[model samples]
Target: MLLKGKTAIVTGASRGIGKAIALGLAREGAQVVLAARSAVSREGGLEGSIQETAASVEALGGQALPVQCDVTQEESVQAMVQAALAAFGTVDILVNNAGVAFFYPITETPLKRWETVLRVNLTGAFLCARAVLPAMIARKKGSIINISSLAADERDAGTVPTGVAYGVAKAGLDRFTYGLAVEVGQFNIAVNGLKPKEPVDTEGMRFWTKPEERQGWVSADKMVKCALFLAAQDASGVTGTVSTDEELSLWHGL
Candidate 1:
């Protein structure tokens, strides 16, 4: 078990890549804190829920704590962090996987929608990182994985862009990952940004694109593997990286 005796706090863990990462960590003997806004997939995006995810983690013989968290709110993030600490003693890992994407041109995008995307994707990461750093620094060891996206770059002809706001937000997150890594490296915390090389076949992706358009999409398992690799890194290794799934697989020889 690469993560034996570790405790991880995963945001947006109710479904999709976040849920898969939480399950994968649990299977590797990590206690997991499942944080998300909904207990279930009440918003009609995916199938899993915080309750269901926690139960699955326990079924894998790992501890699990389900907390309803709105990462966009600072108090909510702080409370979630406290809940994790209360449940598992301390957090050894934090996966900033909570995010929202809007796929529209700037001309059609509403100011509120753009702001919402940035708030959830960028500011939320900052809040969660801030909330977890004290515990991690005190322990002098930890990992922070920021879930970035290929959408950080402008898309080409074969793909659709994830909107200007999402791209900008993820770009900001990547910068945050690097800057945070530098600042926290002295405390033995590894911070890195991970982007999917290919689109994962997530429910949200399915809702956005047609079946035929996503024929070559990767499975959530690949992302889980990549996340596991990052989370398992020692404090002295692989900090301040912005890597893709394929890149991580190659580097870690997965």
Candidate 2:
């Protein structure tokens, strides 16, 4: 059990990569907190609600908690962190996986759209990190993982740059991860970024990418496996790096 007896808070865990990460962490024996804007439902993109995720954890002999949080709001994030502490005593890991993407030409992109993307993807991450730092520093141990995208690296060929706001936000997130890692290394908190290839097979992936391109990307499970490894106590010394699912899997022989 890589995460036996630990507590993890995963944002955007209602579905897709976030949901996968939540389950993976729980499977590794961590007490997972499924934090999102709302409860998951059968009709929604998530496989189940936070309750369902928690149920799955209990079935696996682990513990789970469902938390409603709007990562963009400081008060909401603070409240979510408090709830996690109240439930599990402390948070040992934090996953910033909640994000939004938008497609538009730079010339025509609206300010509101850009701001919305930044708020959810970048600012939200910052708020969550801030909310968790005090507890983590007090314990002198923690891990923070930020989910990034390939768009931060390359624009799709001949496609009108699908994620201008997303890309900018993730780029900022990557830098934020690096900066946070440096600032908190002395406190034994590891911060890193994980970037998935384009055309990933997540629900959000399908919504963001074209059908023709879907088969070209990686699976959510692959990324979740990497997240699980990073959340382990064995990964304590690993920090300030960005990893791809394929890269991490090959390195770990998974």
Candidate 3:
């Protein structure tokens, strides 16, 4: 139980990589606060929902608090963080896994679409991190993991029809991780980024990628394990690094 007695707040935790990370933290003895926009409705392409994830966490002998939060909204993010603190005494970990992508050519990309993607993918992460940083600094012990994508490193010309917004936002997230890490290292707060080569198999992935072609993609469980390793003490000296599932498994023997 590497995270025994810890409390973790995982955004977009209803399913996919987020759900996997929440469950992984719970397995390590952390009380997980699962945050998502809506847990029950089938709208917005969200799969399984936060309530479902929370139930699974409880089934594993861990406590769970399902919180409704639209990460793009500052008030919603603040409420979610406050709710987590109310449910649990403090937050020891924050996983910024909530994101959105707009797959389109730059010329055809609508301003609203670009803004939505940026708000959810980058600004949302910023809001959540800002809301949690003060507490984490006060405790002087915390881990913040931002979920990014490999597309951030690749050139858009050769890849699928993904607009500049998604790529630029993810790249910004990576820079955010580095800047936050440097600023908070003295407070014993670790901030790092995780990038997946391909989409994990989830309802969201099915909608975003070719379902049959997702076999070669990294498993959500594998990513979750990597996230746990990052959240552990073994990564005490590691910060500002963007890691992958393969690299993490090799380094942590997962």
Top model number, lDDT: 1
lDDT of 1 by residue, 8-86 (tens): 9999998889989999999999999999998876754567789988888888888899999999999999999999998
Tell me the lDDT of model 3 at 53. 93
The alpha-carbon deviation from the true structure for residue 141 of candidate 1, after best TM-score superposition, in angstroms, is 0.3
> 1 or 2: which has the higher TM-score?
1
Give candidate 1's TM-score.
Answer: 0.96
Q: Report the candidate with higher lDDT, 2 versus 3.
A: 3
- Candidate 3 local lDDT, 181-240, one digit each (tens): 898888999898987755677666666666555566557877887798788642266777
Q: Candidate 2 — worst ten consecutive residues by lDDT sum?
A: 154-163
What overall lDDT goes with each candidate model?
0.90, 0.82, 0.85
RMSD of each: 1.3, 2.4, 1.9
Number of the candidate with higher lDDT, 1 or 3: 1
The C-alpha local distance difference test score for the whole of candidate 3 amounts to: 0.85
Candidate 2 lDDT:
0.82
lDDT of 2 by residue, 168-239 (tens): 898899889889999999898989898774455666656666677655565677788789877763236778
C-alpha RMSD (angstroms) for model 1: 1.3
Instruction: List where candidate 2 sits over 4 angstroms from the true fold.
Output: 42-48, 156-161, 233-236, 252-254
The residue pairs in collision within model 3 are: none
